[model samples]
Target chain A: MKIAFYIFSSLVFVALQTTIFRELTFIGVAPQICLVLVVVAGMLSGKEWGAICGAGMGLLYDIVSGRIVGLNAILFMYIGFFVGVLCKGFFKHKRIVVLFFTAAAELTYSILYYFFAFFIWGQMNIIYVFSKIIVPELLYTTVVAVPIYVLMEKINDYIERKTF
Target chain B: MRYIFEHKIAVLIISLTIVFLVFMASYTSDKARANLGKDGLSTMVLPFQIVFTSVTHNVQDFFAHFGDLEAAGKRIEELETQVAVLENNSRELEDTKLENERLSSLVGIKDSLKSNDSIAAQIIAKDVSNWYTVFTINKGSGDGIADKQAVITTKGLVGYVSEVGAKWAKVTTIINDGTAVGGLVVRTQDVAIVEGEFELQKDLLCKMTYISKGANIVTGDSIETSGLGGIYPKGILIGIIRDVKPETQTVSQNAIIEPAVNFEKVSEVLVLK
Candidate 1:
């Protein structure tokens, strides 16, 4: 049942990212709400579920994007699994930790993406890319990540309560 | 081996990672490697995207009316001035049309774009990642749209169709880093390659490279498709030169172009067949 819900939500998130959020740009960057969802899944469940959820969401995004497939799936799977494992201790359930991890994951994702997508293609303007693309998207994603995290927490809690 | 057996989650993660990496390698090597997954996923998501896009448009239009009231007087004055200029231009255009018909009859040149058919498609969704400037349209192979077809707005060239599915096609806009178009400066007739640069894409601009040092191109010089590239048809307006960067040691002189079609606001496009 949980897996089914994750699959359904993944579809909605992919749709939203490509449509509504695509139109709503902050500093010419959109908030990566899908990444936030992956983080939330890891925090709520465990490493296994987190990685599974991330892989699912990333595959959907890759298919929709029509780019090289499976790149996002692998990156997001690691991010989800590590976040779940690292936050297992005292950091678990803390909103501040979610913000920190979300920012870190976004930074890592942006850098790796730039390296693969642009840098390898001989666009080595890291400073310009960092200032213009990476930083703005990071800040925007970080700010929006909190609210999405909170919302996901509420939903997970509701699901737990209903299941029990 | 015992540890791997005990740690089922770890095994799963490692296995999935390997599978994904392998899949990525294969897909990269063969772009035409059956797109069944992509086609299936796109078909499922297309309806939702259409709904969301329409809702967003409606909301924007609703708010635009409020803003329109404040700008009404200014717009009317602007329109009045435009009407006067258009009337003058229309008279000149009529004479030019007569002259063009005579010249074309003498030369026996046929306009290819006018003879070809085109299909109108609405943008259903944009690229999920900020790194690429691609968009999905509602019409695809099912509607007679095919790969490498030129997409254009009434204003000017938007880009070309990069990938096509049954009912959807992805457009790689001229601002995307992967796109290159053959451009000709209308005034100087100097031909060059217009490419989408990473830095300029953020500002919705492209650059015309391979320009000779002696090229007489200037700011506001109009660019059109040279028809040298097999993809985009000839004589379609690409953009106007915003600025020119002088040649450096390793790089040739290039001019920054502001595309005629505002990518952000373009909702519908015609796919030239």
Candidate 2:
């Protein structure tokens, strides 16, 4: 029952992140609450469950977007696996550290996305993505990180205490 | 690492399962694209898009109402200036009406064009990505809006019906990529093709192509439909030419035009033959 609640809350966060948080784009900075949640899931649920959650989120992202047919799937899955491994040691406490990690994860994802989209897709407009999408998005997402971490932490605590 | 190696079998199986699912889904999507022209994929996706758009619009409306009211004030001031100009023109026309009647009688021409076919429609949804200004209007085949029917604003051309639902229709604006208009320059009597680029800000502008370099095209020339294309009727206003340039060292020229209709604020439209 606790596991079900965690999963459902994560989904709600992801939906809001794409729909509502999406409006908070500041130039290149955009809130990536989904990335933070995926990383947190990997940390808490270990490798197998982390991968499952990553795959589910990736599929949902694909459905909402009109572009990138299977690109999100591969990126999110790999991010989940690595983040899961990275979080094994810090699975409990340390909210500040978790917030830092979330920002780092988002930056890493954005940089990688720029490379794949520019180099692989042969769209040499890296400046447009960096200026219009990436930079401003970074500031917005970083600021949003603190609140998201608090929400995730509260949800985690509520589930563990079985206080539903 | 040791545990991962031991559980390697599960990882391999899961990876294979995902690969297979992706392959199958890709294959199905290819088939879906081929059948898309016949099947109504937009209809299936329309409801979700509408709900999401409405939610976003509500949020934007909350923030933008003040700005809109300010703009309305400025518009009222401009309209008053126009009204003063029209009042002067009406007084001048009052004395010239008999002279105009004598000229028309000599030419043996009708006072105005015939026909009163029109249907009104309200805008339902717009793409928020601002990529395609294609909108759904609350009138379709049932409401006398047929496929490819020309949509117009009080000013001029809006777009044409691209797709139809039971009670709604998707009107693809002239600003959508590759949309071409057979338009005639009002003053020069020269004909040219107007085309759309993917860029939305440029919707207020369209590319007027294939004009002969020798044609005396210039900025501020009014462009209208030439009635060459069966899609739109003759004499419907499109835009005023903002600039004209030679397309190449070749035989054609391209002109930037300011569209008559403000796509961003369209609420209602009329469809006509």
Candidate 3:
């Protein structure tokens, strides 16, 4: 049941990200809802679930919207794993913690993505990319992550109650 | 062995990452790699994208019409004055058209794009990544659209189809870092390569490079496709120069171009067959 739910939700999120959310840009950057989902899944469950959810979402996104295959898959998987492992002992329900982790994950993802996609391709303008793209996206994704986390928490609670 | 047993998830994650890294490496190195996964995924998602895109457009049009009502009177007044001006200009244009037709027959000049077949397609979605300026259109190989085909709007050049599936195609726009087109300056007749840069994409602009050092190119100069590359037909308007940067130590002089098509508002395009 959990697997089915995750797969269904991932499909919906990927659809939204590519179509509606693609138009909903704040300062030319869309909120990374899939990233938020991975972070929330990690925080709610554990490393294994987080990594699984991340890989699933990343693979869906890459197959659907990404130009290069498996790029987002690897980035998202590690983000999920690290967030899960690091936030293990913390009060996972805290909004501030979710926000912080989302921001950190977004930053890490953006930097790593930039390094692979642009930096090695001779686009050596980190300052400009940071100012123009990364920061705005980070703030936007972080702010958007809160509501997504809340919603996911509700779903997780419902699933847990049903399971046990 | 104890540490590995204790951190099984970490090891698993590392192994998966390495596997994906290999996939990425192979995918990049081989352009002709099997795209069964991509094609299957795209085909499945294309219907939902079309539905969502249509709904969004309808909603936008609804609000846009409501807004238009408030400005309708003012717009009518302005349009009335413009109509009168356009009427006079149309008469002059008719004479010019007749003269051009006569001169063209004498010169044996041929119209390029008008002679080719074209398919109209609606844009279903923009690229999900913030780094690239790509968009997916509803038409694809099934509709006679293919990779590297020129895409345009009534205004002018949009870009070219970079990838195609059965029912959808991805277009890499002129502002994307991956696109390059042969451009000719109409005023100076100077030919150069127009290319998209990562930084310039933020402003919906591109750069025309490889101009001769002594070439007299300036701001506001019109640029069109040069027909140097067979991909884009000759004489389609590409853009107008917005700024000219002088030659520097490591780079040649280049002019920034404001593309003829406004990508932000473009919803439908024609794919030249």
Identify the candidate with maximal lDDT: 1
- lDDT (CA) per prediction: 0.88, 0.66, 0.86
In angstroms and one decimal each, the interface RMSD of every candidate reads 1.3, 6.7, 1.8
Model 3 chain B weakest lDDT span, ten residues long: B28-37
| lDDT string, candidate 3, A1-164, tens digits | 78877877787777677778777889888888889989988898888988989987888788776467789998898888889999977974577899999999999999999999789989999999999899999999999999998888899889989999
Question: What is the per-candidate TM-score for chain B?
Answer: 0.91, 0.70, 0.86
**Residue-level lDDT tens digits of model 3 in B95-212:** 9999988999899988786688999999998887788888888887788887789999999999998888878888889899968999999988988999998899988999889888
The segments of candidate 3 whose C-alpha lies over 4 angstroms from its true place after superposition are B1-15, B29-34, B84-106, B248-252
lDDT of 2 by residue, B45-73 (tens): 44554465467668888889987998999
lDDT digits (tens) for residues B1-273 of candidate 1: 899989988899899889888878877623522277789887888888899999999999999999999799999999999999999999999999889979987999877677879999999999898887888999988899888899999999999988889899999999998689999999999999999988889789999999888888899999999999799999999999999988777446889999999999999999999
User: Which pairs of residues clash in candidate 3, taking residues 3 or more apart in a chain or in different chains?
Assistant: none
Give the least accurate 10-residue stretch of model 1 chain A, judged by summed lDDT: A86-95
For candidate 3, what is the total of clashing residue pairs?
Answer: 0
Q: What is the C-alpha RMSD of each candidate to the true structure, in Å?
A: 2.1, 7.1, 2.7
**Candidate 1 wrongly placed segments (more than 4 Å):** A91-93, B1-5, B29-34, B84-88, B91-95, B248-252
Full candidate order by lDDT, most accurate first: 1, 3, 2
